[model samples]
Target: MNYPEFLSYDIALAACAALAVLITLLLLKAFALRHLQRLADSGRLHILRYAEQVVSSTRLPFFTGVALLAGVSQIKLSPMQDRWINYAWVVILVSQIALWGSRIISVAIGNAVARQRTADPATATHLLLAGLAGRILLWSTAALVMLDNLGFNITTLMASLGIGGIAVALAVQNILGDVFSSVSIALDKPFVIGDFIIVDNYMGTVEHVGLKTTRLRSLSGEQIVFSNAELLKCRIRNYRRMQERRVVFEFGIAYETPQQEVERLPQTLMEIVSADYLQTRFDRAHFKGYGESGLMFEVVYHVLDADYNVYMDIQQEINLALLTVLRERNVSFAYPRRMVHVTHLAEPQESAGQAGKLAA
Candidate 1:
C-alpha cells in the first residue's frame, strides 16, 4: 500500500520503536515465567508462591501496558491521540493490578484454609468468599480510578450506587442474611460436614453447607435442609464433638428378692462392665431405693467414644448380660401385684330361734 510521503518516515519510526518495546517486555515476561516454572518443578513454589502469583498474573498485561506506553511516548501525537493512549494504558494498569490482587487473595486465603483444614473442613467456603471479596474490592477500586482518570465524578457515582445498593439489599435481605450466616458458619465452624448435630429437633450429619441452606442426612435415612440464617439461631448439640457419652440406667427387682442377692446384683453388674472396659468406664452401681412394688437400683457409666451405634451396642450387651446373670441366680425382676382378704360375719337369728322354743 502507498503511504503519504510526508508521514512515511514518522510511521516507520513509531513502528520500529513499538516493536522494540514489545519484544523487550516479552523477553522479560518470558524470563519471569521460566523462573516460576522452575520453582514449581522443584516443589519450592510454596515458599515463593506470592512472588509466583505476582509474576503469573502480571505476565501478559504488564508487558502490554509497558509496550503501549513506550510506543506512544516515542511518537508525537495530537491531544486526542495522547488521551486515547493514556486511557488504554490506564485500563491495562487497572486490569493487571486487579488480576494480581485477586491471585494474592486466593493464595493468602488458601494458605489459611489449608492450616485449618483438619479442624474445619468447611474451610473452602471461607476461602471462596474471601477471594470473592478481594476481587470485588480490587475491581471496584479500579472502576473508580478509571472513571476518575476519565474525568468523571466518582463521588456522585458512588452515592448513586450506594442508594441502589441499599434498595437491592432490602429486596433480598433474607437471602443476604443467609449468605452472611453461611460465611459465619464457614469462619466460626460451629459444625462441619459429617458432624452429627442436633439442631432444635433435627438430628443428622451435615452433608452440605451452601450459601442458602445446610443439608443433613438424618437418622431416618432422609435429607433435611434448613436455611443458613435459621440454623444459626438454633441451639446445636454437636454430638460428634463429645468425647464421651454418660449413660444412666435403672432397674427394679422383686421385693421378695433376698438382700444377699440384692447386694450381689451390683457385683455382677461390675463384673459385666469389667468384661468390656475397652470403651466403657464403670462409674457406680447400687441399690437406690424402694419402688412401689420392688427395689430400685441405679447404675452409671461412660462410653469412651461418641459413636451412637457403638454406645447402643454396648448398652444392649450390658442389658442382655444383666438379664442372664439374674436368671442364672433365680433372681426375678418385679411387676405390680395385689393381695386381697375376705371375711364373713354370721347373721343373727335370735327372734326365730326363741319363737320355735316357746311353741315346743
Candidate 2:
C-alpha cells in the first residue's frame, strides 16, 4: 500500500480499536454495577463495598478511554515521535492502574483490620495508624513508579529526594517534630476522639487528630488547633482517664458554738458526704484551724466520674446537704464583730460624785 493508503488503513484500524474498547468498557461497567447491586441486596455489603465498586467501575472506563486516545495519537506520529508518545502513555496508564489498585487493596485491608480491631480494643488505634500509613506508602510508591517510567534514574532521583527531604526536615524541624508526635499520640492512645483533656488551662475535648496538629473543641464551642510537638511536651491531663475525682471543700463554724459541737463537726461533714450517691468514696474531714473570722473545717471526698458537670452537681448537693445538717444541729456560721468599753466615762462620774459629797 502507498503512504496515503497506509495512513488511511491505520486510521481505520485505530478507530475500530477505540470503538471496541469503549463498547467493552461500557459492558464491564454495567456488569460490575449489577454485581454490586446483588451483593448489596444480600446484606453482605459494607461501607467499603460500594466504594470499591465505584472506584473499579469508574477507573475501568476512564483508563480504557485514556488508552484509546493514546493509541490514536500514536498512529498519527512519526516512528521516533510515536516511541516517546507510547512511553509516556504507558507510564500514565501504569500509574493510574497502580493508584487505583492500591486504593482498592488498601480499603479492603483497612476494613478487615478494622473489623478485627473492634474485638480487641487495644489494637484499634494501631490498626488506624496502620491504615493511614498504608495509604501514604501507596501514593508514595505510585509517584516513584511514575517518575521511574519517565526515563528518570530512580536511584539518583531517590537519593536527591532524600537529600531534599532532609533539608526540608531541618527547615521545618519543629513542624516535623509535631507531626511525629501526633503519630506517637495516635499510637500510644493517650487520648482518643471525644476525650476531655486539659493542657495548660486550655480544657477541651479532642475533636480530631491530623497529620501535624490536633483539633480541640473547647467547652465554649471554639475549635482550637495545637501543635502536637508542643502538646506532647506540655503536661497533659486527660480527664477521661480519671476513675474517680476527689472533691475537697472548706467551711467555717462560729466560735460561739459549744466546744462539744465544734468537735462533732468533722463527723457531721463525713456523714453528709457518705450519704450522697454523688460521693464515690469519702476520705476524711478535719477541723483544720481558726480562720480570720470563723472556725474552718475541711471536707474531702471522691466522685464517681471526672466529668465537670457531674463533679459540680455532686459538690453542690453535698454543700446543700451540709447546710441542712448544720442548721438542724444549731451550728451557725461565724460573722465578724467588735466590742467597745465605756470605763473612762464611768470613772469620771464617780469622781464628780465624790467631789459633790465633800462640798456638802
- Predicted structure with the largest TM-score when compared to the true one: 2
* Model 2 local distance difference test score: 0.77
Q: Give the per-residue lDDT digits (tens) of candidate 2, residues 79-142.
A: 8877677676767676666666666766665666567553653354455566677778877887
CA shift of 305, model 1, Å: 2.4
lDDT of 1: 0.83
TM-score of 1: 0.63
Worst 10 residues of 2 by lDDT: 117-126
Put down candidate 1 lDDT per residue, 59-177, tens digits, no spaces.
65567667767766777789999898888888887778777877888788778867765676666556656666777788888888888998889889989999999999999999999
RMSD of each: 8.5, 5.5
TM-score of predicted structure 2: 0.76
